[model samples]
Target: MLLVEDEDSLREILREFFENRGYEVIAVRSGEEALEVISNKKFQIGLFDLKLPGMDGIELARRARENDPDMLVLIMTGYPSEESVKKAAESGVYDYIVKPFRLEELEKIIEQVTKEWRMSRENRRLRKKLADLEGEIW
Candidate 1:
């Protein structure tokens, strides 16, 4: 997973929290750093803060999806607005999480998103297999 948050303490805390749970977390302080890091690696999920110092979360989400279309992105914000929500939706964020969220809640959301992504991938694979069989029969 890729965790992006600007605040030093929060970043460290989240990194520890996820790592303790056996998640391989690559935490970064800014979207620019995330982009650089992601350029070399891929993550199954991304936890991004919306109000980043440079290249906000929405843009990062977009680029992340471009790198890994099946990646699940969750946006976190201390300050939420209609525009940001709309932008996040447009960026294909999997979910929006408010600041001061419970760790358990975030964990649940992560599980749900990953489960859905896996199901969708499986469905796509099945569809492709059926198509191939139909072509062979025809």
Candidate 2:
């Protein structure tokens, strides 16, 4: 996973937290850098700060989804407002949370999304195998 935030303190803390939890966290300070890293690498999820230096989190989410429609994005913001929430929801983000968010809550969201992704993939594989077997028998 990749984390995008400009705040040095928060960025460091979250990096340590997720890394300790067994994620190979690539933490970036700006949205532009985040996009560069993501475009080259394969990441299971993204945690983006809403008020990024080069690009806002909402726009980042939009572009990332365009590049990868199944990308699971969780947007974070210290600034809270109805308009921001509305815009984020419209962009097809997996989830968004206002900051001062709990690490536990973030972990939970990440875990659930990862689990769902795995389950869906496994189900698809099983269905494909079943179809192949039935065709061979017929």
Candidate 3:
């Protein structure tokens, strides 16, 4: 998982929270840094702040998805606007979370995303296995 938040305290809290829950989280302070990390590693999920110093979350999500289409991205914003929400959806974000949110709420969202991600992964694996078996039979 990749977590991008500009606020130092919030970033630390979120990183610790996810880490304690057994997520291998790479936390960064900017979209630029997140992009750099994404270039080197593939993440199953990404949590990005909508506002950042450079390359806002929607753009970051778009670029990240270009690298890994299967990645699920959730955007967090203190200032939620209809325009931002529309843009986030257009970028294929899995969800948009408003700030001042409860940690439990975030956890529930993560759990749901994880379930879907696992199901999708399993489906792909099964398809590959079936294809290989068919090739063998032929």
Candidate 4:
């Protein structure tokens, strides 16, 4: 998992929280740092704070998708606006999580997102296989 948050306190808290749960998290303070990591590593899920210093979470999510189309993006925001919602939708984020959220709720959402990621991966694999078979048949 790739976690991007500007606030140092929340970043450390979330990093420890997710790490304790057995996730090998690459936590960063800014979207620029996140982009650097995303270029090298492929993450199944990306949890980004909507408000970042340089490149906001929405733009980060969009760029992350360009790098890893299969990555599942979840945005964390303290303040949600219609503009943010529209941007999230445009960015192809899996969901937006409100800050001050219960850890339990986040755990559940992570579980669901992981499941969705696996299913999407499997579907892509199956589609490729079917296409290959069709090519051979023709």
Candidate 5:
């Protein structure tokens, strides 16, 4: 998991929370830092704060997807705006999470998304294996 949040306390809290839940989390303070990490590592899920010091969540999500289309992105915003929400959708963000939310709510969302992500990964692997087998038969 890749976590990008500007708030120090919230970042630490979320990092510890997910880590305790058996997730290997890479938490960063800014989108730039996240991008640096993203280039080297592939994360199945990314939780990004909507507002960042440089490169907002929407842009980061879009760019991250360009690097890894299978990466699922969730945007977290304390100040939610209609325009921003629409932009997030346009950027292919998987979900938008309003801040000051219950941890359980986030956990539920993560669980569901994780399940779907795993399924998709398995599907892709199967498809590739099928293609390889067909090639061998031919």
Candidate 6:
């Protein structure tokens, strides 16, 4: 898991919280750091605060998707403008939570996305097996 927030306090809190929940978190301060980590590592899920210092969360998500299109990404923001929310929503972000978000709710979103990822991975494997079997049959 990757957590990106410009606020040090918030980033630490989220990192600790997710860690306590058994997630290996790579928490960072800016979207620049987030992008670097995303490009280098394969995290199951990424949580980004919308207004980072160097790059906004939306753009970070875009770049992350470019690196790994199946990665699950969640966006959080204290300042949720209509345009930003709409834009992020359109980009297939996993979920959005406003600041002061409840830990329980965040857990639920994580669980939901994890479940979906598992199913998608299983489906992909099955499809590949089917294709390979068909090729062998011919």
Cα lDDT listed for each candidate: 0.93, 0.87, 0.96, 0.94, 0.96, 0.88
Clashes of 5: 0
Candidate that scores best on TM-score? 4
Report lDDT (Cα) of residue 105, candidate 6. Answer: 90
Instruction: Name the lDDT value of residue 127 in candidate 1.
Output: 100
lDDT of 5 by residue, 1-138 (tens): 999999999999999999999999999999999999999999999999999998999999999999999999999999999999999999999999998899889999999989999999999999999999999999
Candidate 6: list runs displaced more than 4 Å: none
lDDT of 1: 0.93
Q: Is candidate 1 or candidate 6 better by lDDT?
A: 1
Pick by TM-score: 2 or 3, better one = 3
lDDT of 2 by residue, 35-132 (tens): 88878886768888999897899899888878776678889998988998888989877788888889998889989988876787789899999999
Clashing pairs in 4: none
TM-score quality measure for candidate 2: 0.86
- Among all windows of 10 consecutive residues in model 4, the one with the lowest summed lDDT is 5-14
Taking the tens digit of each residue's C-alpha lDDT, what string does model 3 give over 55-88?
9999999999999998999999999999999999
Give the least accurate 10-residue stretch of model 6, judged by summed lDDT. 35-44
Residue pairs with backbone overlap in model 5: none
Candidate 5, lDDT over the whole model: 0.96
* Prediction 2 global C-alpha lDDT: 0.87
Query: In model 3, how large is the Cα lDDT of residue 87?
Result: 98
lDDT, candidate 5, at 59:
98
Residue 4 of model 3 has an lDDT of 97
- In candidate 2, stretches whose alpha carbon ends up further than 4 angstroms from where it belongs are 123-138
RMSD of each: 1.1, 2.2, 1.3, 0.9, 1.1, 1.1
